[model samples]
Structures are given as C-alpha cells and as structure tokens.
Target chain A: MHLSFSSVIEILGIMAFTVSGAFSAMQKRLDVFGVLILGFVTAIGGGTLRDVLIGNTPVSWLRDVNTPLIILGTTIVTIAFKSSVKNLKVTLLVFDALGLGLFTIIGIQKGMAANFNPGICIALGTITGCFGGVLRDMLLNHIPVLFHKELYAVPCIAGGICYILLRAVVEPQIAEGASVVVISAFRILAVRYNWRLPRV
Target chain B: MHLSFSSVIEILGIMAFTVSGAFSAMQKRLDVFGVLILGFVTAIGGGTLRDVLIGNTPVSWLRDVNTPLIILGTTIVTIAFKSSVKNLKVTLLVFDALGLGLFTIIGIQKGMAANFNPGICIALGTITGCFGGVLRDMLLNHIPVLFHKELYAVPCIAGGICYILLRAVVEPQIAEGASVVVISAFRILAVRYNWRLPRV
Candidate 1:
C-alpha cells in the first residue's frame, strides 16, 4: 500500500530518532537488549508525552506499532553497521540535529492543528523535541545534554514560533520546511561554535 | 491559612513517594544529587504527567514551590540517615505501599473530578501510582520492579476499582479511606506472601 505523504515524513523522523538513540546507547556500552529499550524509549518518550498532554489516548505509539518496528529495525541496522557508528561522531550529530528539527516542527504543527495558542504550541514542540534525548541521558545516569547547556531547547522554541509566524504570513508548507531549516541551522551552528548557556 | 482537605492528603502522598524514591536510590548506591533527583521525580512525576495529560498549565509542581521543598527535605533526610535506610527496608516498603495506595486514589479521584470515564480513571491511577518508580528504576539501570513478575500494579488496579465503586456506594470521605486501606493491605499481603505475575 502506498503511504500518505505525512506518514512518510513521520516515519523518517522516527527512524532518525531511533538510530540516534541506539547510537547513544552503544556509546554507553549497554547490552543489545538494553540498546533496544533505550532506542525505543528515546524514540517514543517525547511524542508519547506530547500526545498524552494533548489528550491523545493510548498514545501515538501504542496505537501505531509501525513506529516501534521502525525503531527496532534501525537498531538492527546500527548493530550491523557498528564499525561505521564507531567512527562517525560528526555524522551521528548531524542526524540527531535533523531529528530534532523535524520532530519539533511536527509537534508544533500538531499543537496548532489542535488550535492551541502559539505559546502552548511552542512549549509542546519544545517538549516533543528535547524530552526524548533528555530521558535517554537521564536513564543512562548522565546529566542530560539539555540541562548541561547546549543551546538546544531554545532553538526548538524559537523555530516553533517561526513556523507559526511563517504560516500566518505565507504558504502552509513553507512553515514546515522553513521551520525545520531554521532549527537545523541554528543547532548545527551552535555545535560548530561550541555555544552554550551562560553559567550565571 | 486553612488548607483544602485534598491538598493535605496530596502533600502526605508526595512526601511518602519522595521518601520511598530516596530510599530506593540509596539502595542502589547513587550520590546525594542522584538521590535528590530521584526523590523529586518520584514525588512529582506522576502528578506532572497527569496534569499535562489533562492539558493543565505549568504542571502541578511548577505551580507550587512547596512540592520541591518537600522532595528536598526527603532527600536530605534520607542521606543524613543513610545507615537507617538499609535497616528500615521493611518500613520503607510499607511507606512505598502506602504511597502507591494514596497515589492510586488521588489519581482516580482527580480523573473523576475531571469527569473522566472509569476506564481512563483506572489507567490514570495506575500510571500515577506506578510510573514514578518505573522511572526511578529505569534511570538506575534496572528493569522496573513493577513489571517484574509482581503484585505491584495489581494493588493499584484493585484500589482504583474500589475507589470508583465505593464512591458509587458510599460517602466520598469514607470511600477515600476505604480504598487506601484496601490498596495498602493488598500490597502488604502480596509482599509478605511473595505474590507476583507469572513470567511470560
């Protein structure tokens, strides 16, 4: 069966998220089963949360096993490609940044579609984008990257607003693509320059 | 100032949950800061998720600093009396069971106040009563004790049914105490007898 356009993008975003999570678990030297759990939780945790907050019962993931399957599949692929994962920190970071941009925009779009106000939409989007990674890090007994200052949550928040304003001023599709671009660029640039939150 | 009746019970439940979490963290040999995070999360995580699901603003703990203070107090007390924690495992287990009972009732009660269905109310109660510990264990890199062939989720489920049914048959205050007693006794008995879900 032919997949819908939106489902395709969502599948890609979810796949990217799962791969990043698996790689992080691998970095921590977790066992294979542990890697699977970490990837599954990290891929689903934020969206499960966003959906729960938005009153989506059974959660988006519990309703759709495909997402979890995709994560499991990606984890297998990562395991098969362990050598590459070992030498590709830059590439992994790029993929993580991409997932961050994509998921955050989609979350904001969902909130707006539900007709929540811009501020709430932005907050939902921020939660959707960063929470998975935060959870994964926390579960690994490490301080989450978001908490340790990475200029992370702010970009999601700002780009969510950009999506809202972009749609209001222009075409609808531009809002999605443009907002993703804004977040991705900001995140990559922040990493490139070692930007971080102020200590004070 | 005169506190609302429910608020007093809520604070007690939070304290119990916080103390239980801190004790568990100490059992796992986490640092002082780790104990603090565990306590805070256990105390507030369930309610935060519940409020967010209902689309409440700012989250419950964020709305009141007192919750943070309570969690902090629990953490400090647990650390200061770390030696006592080991010897007090049975006592901690009893309080943990109490926390589970109280949280189930409160979550079910909250859902009822929001006019949620019995099915959803039971689920909310289960989630509220259990997810915090699941989270604590997962973060400590252990499989959740609840999912481990155990009587953990059962008491919460039974208690929720009692809360819903008793409210239908009796006064609200009496139903509250009755549900708590039912849940607490159920958990204590299960622990004493080593009852659990059979392995899949």
Candidate 2:
C-alpha cells in the first residue's frame, strides 16, 4: 500500500512522539512495560483524542496496524540506546518540532473533514500538536508543558489559522506544506529564543 | 422531561465529580475559570473518553446541555462553601463512592451497547469509574490516584466483573443495581479500613 504525503508525516510524528515518550520513561526509571505504554500513549494520544471528539470511533491507531508497530519499533530503539539518545538533544528537538507541526495540520484537516466550526478546528489543531506531551507529562506526574510558559500551542494555533487562510488562495497540498513549515519554524525559533507566554 | 432512575444516578455522579474537581482546584488556588474548567473535565472526562472510544460523537455533555449546567452549579456551590465542605469528609466520601459506582455501570452499559468484547467492556467500566479523578489529579500536578497505592480501580474492576456475572443470572436492570451497590459498598469499606494496593 502506497502512503500519501499526509500519511508519511503522520508516521514521522508517531515515531518522534514515541521516542520522546520512551526517553521520558527512561529518565523516570519506569519498568519496561511502563516505558512501552508511555511510548504508545505519547505517539497516538492526541490523535486518539481528536478522533474521539469528532465522533470517529476505534481511533486511527486501532484501525491501522502499522501505527502501533512503528511506535513499538521506536520504543525498542529508544530503550536500546537510552544513554546515547540523551546526548542527542538537538536532533530530538528537531524531531519533536516536526511531529508537532505535522500533528497540528493533521488535526485541523480532520476537524475540517468532520465539518466542525473554525474555532473547533483551531482547538483541535492545538490539541493534536500539544496534547501528546500533556498526556506524557501527566502520566509522569508533572505539569503539562502547554499549561506553562511554553510558546507551544501558540504556534499550532497560528499554523491552524494559516492553513485556513492559505487553503483559499493556494493549492490544498501547498497550504498544508506551508502550514507545517510555519509551525515547525515558529516552534524551533521560539525555543531557541526562549520565548514564553507570560505567567498567569 | 421526567428523568429515569439511571439518569438521576448519572447526574449525581456528575455533581459529585464536579465538586471533587472544584475542591482540588481551590486547594491549588486556581482562578475561577480554572476551577470551572477542572470541574467540568472531572465530571465528564471519563464518560467522554468512553463515548469517543465507542464512536459516540459530540459526547454526552455536548448533547445534553444540562451536564455542563450541573457542573457549573456544583463548582459554584463548592467555591461558596469551600471551608465548610472541607469538614464534611464522610459526606464527600459517600458521594464519591456513589459517583464511582454509577459511572462504572454507565461505562459498562455503553460498552455493551457498542457490542464491545467483555474484556473491553470491563476496562471501559473501570476507566469510566476512575479516570475523572485521574484527569483531576493530573491537572493538579499530582500523581493519579489510580496509579498509586489507592484501592480505587480495584473496586471498579470488581464491580465490572460482578456486573458481567450478575447479568447472566438476573435482569439487566437488577444486575446493574447490584453492581452499583457492590462497588459503592466496597469502595467505602476499603477507604474506611485504609486498604491499599501494595506500592511497587
């Protein structure tokens, strides 16, 4: 089965999130089963939420066998190279940004497909981009990254708006690609510059 | 509209969970909006999850406007009587147990309605009974009660098993009522006896 561009991005996002989750589990010294569970949840938690909210049942991961396989594979890789991977901060950051961007677009697209209102679509997009980390942090008994000073969900919301606006003037694929690029660049720049939302 | 017996139980569960969430938010010194958000999430989070898994769309809260109204009312009441309510530990415990039992049965019924496997049904029941508190604790940056030494999910799972078994021997309504009673009594007893799952 040939994969589409969106599917490719989705798989990449899954792998990135899985690796991130596995690393967190390792840092916490969770059991092997805990590591695997965290990886699986991080990779698909946001999408599962989006799908469920839109009334899509069983979720995409349950329908696509490859989703779990990829997450499992990523978890295995992370477990094997746990110590070495900890040193690859820049690479992991890049991958996380990529996943965030891709998931934001994917969530917005799904919401659009379901004919949700624009506000709902934007919210869905933000949830998709940021919620995996929320679930990961929650499971690890920490505050969610999004609820803090992070400029995380802001970029996702910006990208969602860009997608909505660009789709009218540009081709569908172009709009998607542009939105992903915008989100990724904004996220990476925000982190590099230490940009943060003001403390409430 | 005249309410059914089950609907009354569901509303009670919602109110109990909402008050629990509001109290947590208050303890954490969250703002009014934060308190309301937490209250709403705690009341409907588990049921929303179960509904989404079963392909039920828009979730129950969205369909029934009363759900949010009830949560809001509960939150207001909690905020107004916060100090006094703190002294009512036994009353709160009873309400929580009632909510847990009702939610467990509701989740199992939903899973059965969706034609899920028995294992899945039981899991759904457990999730429904316990996950609201999980979400509440997570949002409050504490470890989920279910993940720790608390004898929380055990009663839910036991109730689910009882529900399944009793359904085979009695009428569906009778089975449900019996399961709810068993769950509430077991939970209250466990708490009173300071029963706990051994720490890992």
Candidate 3:
C-alpha cells in the first residue's frame, strides 16, 4: 500500500507505543528477548486484534516489515532515554494521548474500510487505540489500567464516534483529519484539566 | 464436547494454574478483580490462544461456563491459602509444572484436530503453554520468566512430539492417555531434577 502522511504518523504512533511498552518491560528488569516481545505486542497488538476479529488474514505487522523497524527503533530510543524520561512522565502522557487519538481514527477508518457495522467499527477503533496497552498489561499480569475508570478508552470511543458522525456531515478526508484532532484534543484537555467519568 | 477422563484432568490442571496465578496477583497486592484476571489468564490463556489460532469462535472460556467457575474456585482457594502458599514457592512450581504439561498436550491435540501441520501444531502447543506467562509479565512491565533461556519452550515441544510419536504406536484412546501422562511426568521430573537445556 502507498504510504500517506497520515499513515506515516500512524506508523510513528505505533513506534511510540512500542517504545513505551519496551520501556515498561525494562522497568520490570526483563531480558532483551522479553523487551522485544513487549515492543512487538505494543506495536501491533491492538491492530492485530482488530484485524483478527474482522477475519483479515496476515496480520498488519506481518504484512509490513517496516513495522518491526519502527518498533525496534522505538525500543532503542526508550532504553537510551530511560533515565531522562523519569522526570518527564507528563511529556510521555501527552505523547501517548496523541498516539491514542491518531490510532483511534485510523482504527475506525480501517474498520469502515472492512465494512463492519457502526457499533463494531466503533468498538474496533477503541480496541485498536487502547487494547494494545490492555494486552500489554494483561501479559504483565496486572489488571488492565483502562478498566480502572480511566479516561483512556473513553477518548478513543469518542474519537471513533466523532469520525463516523463527522463523515456523515463532511468529506471522508476531512472527517478523518477531524476525528484524529478531536480524540487527541480530548485526551490533552482531559489530562490537563483532570476530567474523568463518574465512577460507581 | 463430552467430558472424558482427559478433559477431567485438563480442568484439574487448569484449576491448579488458576490458583497459582491468582496467588501471584495477590502477592502483588492486587484487588479482587485483578486477582480474577490473573487467574483467568493463568488457567485459560494457553487454551484460549490455541482456540483463537485455530479459528475457534468465541474462544473456549466463552464456550464453557464451567471453565470460569473452576478458575474462580481455584482463586478462592488460592486467596484463602495465600500466606501458606506465599512461603511455599516449591509447591507452586509443582502445580505450574503439572498445568504446563497438561496444557501443552491439550493444545497440540486441538491443533491436530484442526488439521494444522505437525510443525505448526508443536509450535502452537509451546505457544499455548507459555504465551500466557509472557503476557502476564508484559502487563506488569516486567521480563517474562520464560524467555530467560530456560527449559520452558523446549519441554513443551518435547512433550508435543511425544504425543505425536506415541500415537503412531498405540491405539487412539491409550495414545491420548499416554501422551498427557508423558508430558506431565516429564514436567514434574524436570522441575524436581532441575533439568534444563544447556546454555549457548
């Protein structure tokens, strides 16, 4: 497939997640192979789940070798800057938010392309944006952080829905751009302002 | 599927894994929900992956309500005996070994039933036996114990090969029984004797 600007951003976002995932594993003092596994999952886990659920063959990472390089580069960068990142957790948060929104829109777009129902498309987009982290945590034996009343999944879903609604009113390209911005903006505002859903 | 003796043993093995997984979560000071997730992954994760790779819809736990119950029961028992088991790592090893062996054989059987190639079947069995632990550690942002150049994947392959070879010589029913026994026995003995592959 020909690469677009948005696709480049999306791939870069995957790289960022893979780096963080690798860093997370390193925080646990995992070995090199273990770090690679964490990186691999974080990079492709959500998208793989989305594709599998949609019955798409040859998972996304398998389709493109560049995906692994992105993951590898991210992992290397993460390890190199580990100590520096300790004081920059807030920066990390912002970056993660951007990736989250970007990935969510891309996920929804992928789902729509696959011709799934609106509900499932929204769900897949959310899964694609968020479930990679969930899978990473689940693999690490922690209850997924998302289920703990966080604003994570919400923004992804909101972005996906925004994309669908935006598409109904706007051109496809415009809708995609708007959806990414909406989700990313929501994440940024939520973090800065301490927005959260009501907990039972 | 009708419950056979093999099925009964498989459930028992899963119960053991669930107990230990929940116990590990408890040691980490996880809440009730977290413990359940750990137990669920420890017990059913291997088989669940096997089912998914084989294109089994809804996965095994979704197909079998009793599976969750067994995990729940095991979790309750594990939590009840948390203090005792916390100090008894060796006992946990025993159960983990047993579960590991049983899960491997079951995974290989399922793969064969799906008519996957033998090489893929063995790979699937090892993956089924071990990926859960890899996932567990990844979630915790830690290194997976399995990828530490240990006897982990090797033993699973060994056991799976045993099943395939034994089937060539024995009747179907006896072969199934023998396969499970051989795998479990090797697992137990390996742990007891500290048997492991040589370092490169």
Give the top-scoring candidate (DockQ).
2
Q: Tens digits of per-residue lDDT for model 1 on A1-200? A: 89965566566667767777787888899999989988887888888777776666778777777888899998898888878755876766676677788889878877777776676677678878888877888778775556445677878977988998898898987788888888888998899998875331
TM-score per model over all chains: 0.57, 0.62, 0.58
Pairs with steric clashes in candidate 2: none
lDDT of 2 at A106: 83
Please report how far candidate 2 places residue B142 from its true position, in Å.
2.9
Cα-based lDDT at residue B117, candidate 2: 68
- Winner on TM-score between 1 and 3 is 3
Docking quality of model 1: it rates as incorrect
Report each candidate's C-alpha RMSD, comma-separated, in the order given. Answer: 8.3, 6.7, 7.6
lDDT of 1: 0.77
TM-score value, chain A, candidate 2: 0.95
Chain B TM-score, one value per candidate, order as shown: 0.89, 0.95, 0.86
Judged by lDDT relative to the true structure, which candidate is superior, 1 or 3? 1
- Taking the tens digit of each residue's C-alpha lDDT, what string does model 2 give over A80-103? 887787788788778788889989
TM-score of chain A of each: 0.90, 0.95, 0.90
lDDT of each: 0.77, 0.83, 0.74
Clashing pairs in 1: none
Q: For residues A21-58, could you state the per-residue lDDT of candidate 3 as single tens digits?
A: 87767766665555666777777788878878877644
